[model samples]
Target chain A: MTAVLALLEFAPGTGATTGFRLVDPAQPHLTVTDLAATRGDGIFETARVVDGRVQALEAHLERLAQSARMLELPAPTLPLWRDAINAVAVALAAAGVADGSIKFVLTRGIEGGQVPTGWVLGLPSPDFTRERAEGIRIVLLDRGYRHDVAHTSPWLLAGAKTLSYAVNRAVLREAARRGADDALFVSSDGYLLEGAVSSLLLRVGSRLVTPRVDIGILAGTTQADVFNWAELQGFTTGYELLTPGDLATADAAWLVSSVRHAAPVRAVDGVERPIDAELTARINAALDGRID
Target chain B: MTAVLALLEFAPGTGATTGFRLVDPAQPHLTVTDLAATRGDGIFETARVVDGRVQALEAHLERLAQSARMLELPAPTLPLWRDAINAVAVALAAAGVADGSIKFVLTRGIEGGQVPTGWVLGLPSPDFTRERAEGIRIVLLDRGYRHDVAHTSPWLLAGAKTLSYAVNRAVLREAARRGADDALFVSSDGYLLEGAVSSLLLRVGSRLVTPRVDIGILAGTTQADVFNWAELQGFTTGYELLTPGDLATADAAWLVSSVRHAAPVRAVDGVERPIDAELTARINAALDGRID
Candidate 1:
């Protein structure tokens, strides 16, 4: 079993992850010149691997398929992608990772005949000392994405995990530039959107609320899970349009995602608030994990 | 020289371009995985190569460098890129391509350390046949790009040719969907923007007009050249804001770029028009032998 475990682990120089072959560890050969890179025409997803198994694997697969459908690209066969994702998870588990992260992606294949070349990438998980339910700091930035684009903008991947993330990365960079850890995108008309890469939730006194899907916010898998768990815990939940000021005035705030789980918000626009231990307790209880 | 050219024409399997050393072209490769595939974080330019030289080489390089700067990625050293472009042109010319198109690109390098990776890519000239300047059919679509974003949107490449071209491709696809060969993006407010892949130009009687730089249009190098030559030929030239109705009503319209040179707009929204022989004559005369 130990030898088998050693075989599965992907070291820096070994070059292979799971059964899916890797070209090289340093610089693998890839058909990158295709339309995917050239045109931003693809979709991707990240999954958490724990104890040699992928968490919420079905949800990630559904999202990947849905995103491809939205992009009008052919969706990858689920069995093949599942096999690939499992292999990476098993490999990481064999390498002494009791828990880690696995990233799965389906992209439009190389630029040629018709379909896009999809890819599945896996990486090691981060080391989390403990869940910091204490909260996080957020800055609001305008992405100028129109609200009505929920159904109109053909390129509105705002609700889907499309491969065109240059702007999302830029949003985070802008937040970092302003000395904030994360950014919450506000529409040009002042309505609150989602965070740079996470879904936003605010605690207005007793009821927890987030933007509705009609507002073009991504239907976050982790956010959904947290919402369900919150309901079970007897916490009231609602979806509503919000402004940045609404978040600033909230008694509790959290950014929810697969990797981050539930990250509580401590401040907005330089205004700090007391850490809501009760809210953190509820979120962590819902996530069944610690926020790293 | 043909033998030298043979060395430059890389087989698709080889993934090597004439000027650069592409040792690997598979996944996990620094050049492929980090820069080309993952983040969609790169920039590129497409221009024509004539004889043994790249057309408007300096202008393309300027745009490439500017895009790199806007993306916060390092610009490829101009001398190295210049040498690369030249070598590729030589190879193409040697391959019997007296007139052809060339694509030059730079991307964020491979992902490592703190920042994402960057890469540079080059491809052979496209096959373009010299036509009798019969115009193309154009359709107007809203691109959701604001006018002031021409200078205001920092994360946006604006006029810079960044890798996030999904919107551009979408416009072209929309045009094709509507049975047109190309499209001219109209602002939500109905002001004519640029073409999906070319600069917009109109001939209102004797005067040749294109959108001004303030209109959030790419300041086209070929259009500038045409304007300069048109001025030399005593043809009136001006820049103005054009509406979709105005474009449809123009005496003549054309899409200008390095590759297309000066393709005429034969129709807009199914409304047919006669090609302006005088305008075509002036464009051909202006562009003749200037590229090489």
Candidate 2:
């Protein structure tokens, strides 16, 4: 079993001194009525942490705020989250977790309480060296929504990062059952949306391409950072509607995310695709940095 | 704030005596790593309790089993759930809750633990007298899926009653913002699907109609029971593809669920619709019975 290394809980108006508490990871710490647990009524973010420092802290915080807004939640400010993240990161480091993951969660609180529950959890990162070095086999699954659904249906919460990820988890399970390592969701109309847990990126000639987020996909923060860094390295980026055929014909493809960084996709639906080791290393190098 | 009236925890292998424990509602009782809270990965059922007896107990249990199977969970046996439900229902009644609700929840459990967390929660039922007697105003909202989406994609959890209810809650909030009592979801192709929290039913001339469940909507247990009763009363029930205009022109329409039973639709999108008080009374009478 993967152990929860450290945890910190924060409730609004409790103040830093009394609100945050270091809790035993093995013990139960939430009420059964919490909406997050009962109804998946919440939002969350997971980021990579190294040597007590969190990577892309500002970006993760910004996305968390945006998700809170989309859910109509009164999100705790960035500084409050910063304090909680820093506290968890320090505790994890002191517990000897060098390279790990930090999760920021904001739940709708207990049923009808009208107060939000916020917390930070730190755990040792899963070793993705095999996926990063050997690459992964992915299957194409239909997400059952048209690309234009998000634009017209805001209540569907197309792009917001909510905790209602049962579908995403189910897709991954189905992929595993089909002998695939991961799954990339295709819209009902055959347009590529995103991976279950990461964003899809492809290299077509000199330009790097990704699916447009306006089509009801969560905007990948890691993909955004990589694109910005790639642009600085003289690479152009484009957001286009991609299809499975486009992915199969691309020079290279990768699943980009905050914790896993960039994992090369060696095959799509059992058909072998090109794996660009040079491009993979370049992307990882761009993401390599220390957070203060 | 709505207070949790009663709760009972049940885990497999603990036996009936050890497994069922009446818990204080105000305390924190779940681990922070519980997948139900973190990922909304679970299944739930809410049934009405009248005069210390649960209504439609067998039907709710069957649907709960179905949902658990869909989510790949190891569901507790019907006898076990019956024991827990009976225990909680008795305690709630002892606490003077005559007309209440009993909720059965089974979560994916704590991260890496692989054990399912099952519990029964008892709360006072919200009074729906006005909505039942005076009727409710509703609006049409797009569910962002085609009617055929469920047939092709089982991983989307089309008919499974999962805990990822963020979208449902969001739609209700949007409806409140628009000054409507509730919202009924329409498919991307303009077919009426179901309500966020209930099932849609309408009467057209001598025939009663509802959207087919194959279109990725949870099959409402109450709706099914009502249909069976209506059929016994010589009302023909037809599962057909319905549009917004069909609802507007219907002789009578209703949003039915276990707790609310059958609520008449007074209007849709601010346009008045016909309501059949006689039909509504008959439907309520059909559900007026106590469980053994």
Best by lDDT: 2
Off by over 4 Å in 2: A1-19, A290-292, B1-18, B290-292
lDDT of 2 by residue, B3-46 (tens): 34333344444322235566776788788888898888999999
How big is the RMSD of model 2? 2.6
Each candidate's interface RMSD (Å, one decimal) is 3.3, 0.9
Task: Place model 2 in a CAPRI quality band.
Answer: high
| TM-score of chain B as predicted in candidate 1 | 0.83
Q: What's the true lDDT of residue B193 in model 1? A: 80
Tell me the DockQ of each model, to 2 decimals.
0.38, 0.81
Assess chain B of each prediction and give its TM-score.
Answer: 0.83, 0.93
What is the lDDT for B225 in model 1? 82
